[model samples]
Target: MSVSGVREAAAIWARAKARRDRDPEPATVEATAPGIRRRLDLPGAKLLLAERGGRPVGFALVAPRARTLELFYLAVDPDAWGSGVGSRLLQDVEQHAREVGREVLELWVINDNERAIGVYERAGWVGTDEVERDPASGRLERRFLRHIG
Candidate 1:
């Protein structure tokens, strides 16, 4: 989506985010739209969306983090969770990252989000004990990354 559409895009974000806490500010879709889009469009950033049957089902957002590509955000429609959209997005991004000679695909996940962490691990992502809080939740989280060919 374009920057102008950030407001509309915010609605989907509200639906996509799995609640980590009872925070209301981040959940205010309209307010977070602009900043979220700005962050995604920063230098060396990439955003990919997954659509099928004319509807957006997933999105993957990336940004440069030192020598790595940080997966800043990734979300699949709860209804499409097991339909391979997430995996496809990852593979597509991985290929592009490799073509650009990126050393790794890094991302941070909430410690409580075992599902995503497991998915990444299965995709060859390794875990690091170094943890931090997602500003939105203040929950303990860990970083994961995988090297590409």
Candidate 2:
């Protein structure tokens, strides 16, 4: 992802969170873009964007960690929700993991975010017993994992 793409992805992330009513203040790209860029700078990290009509609709960021692929972020524009954009982005993430020789893909989702959790579950990701509190949002998050080869 380029500099501009990171900004766009950040906007989508913020919008998705806001649409779910996750934050009262809602996040801004100015605050989220840096984190996205920092993760993208990591070794073996990949950012996959789903575009429609030459415009970005969703994105997924994954990085290799140990023997698994860690999904750092996945977001779809509110306008594109229920349009299959998120599912396509997830499929791309799984394919990318397979190409990188990583059989396991893992991610953390806020437990209250049922929409996102449902998406992951439909994609065959299983929620594990591991859970943690997000320091930034003070929300509970559960780890989800899937195996693909």
Instruction: Write down the lDDT that model 2 would get.
Output: 0.91
Considering every candidate listed, which one attains the maximal TM-score? Answer: 2
Compose the digit string of candidate 2's lDDT tens values, residues 1-149: 68888988999988887888856665888988988998999999988988999999999999999989999999999899999998998999989998889999999999988999999999999999999999987999999999886
Every model's TM-score = 0.83, 0.94
lDDT (C-alpha, whole model) for all candidates: 0.73, 0.91
Q: Which pairs of residues collide in model 1?
A: none
Q: Give a tens-digit lDDT track for model 1, residues 46-107.
A: 67777889787777777777798888777776677778887888887797687667878888
Q: Which runs of model 2 end up more than 4 angstroms from their true locations? A: 22-26
RMSD of each candidate relative to the true structure: 2.8, 1.4
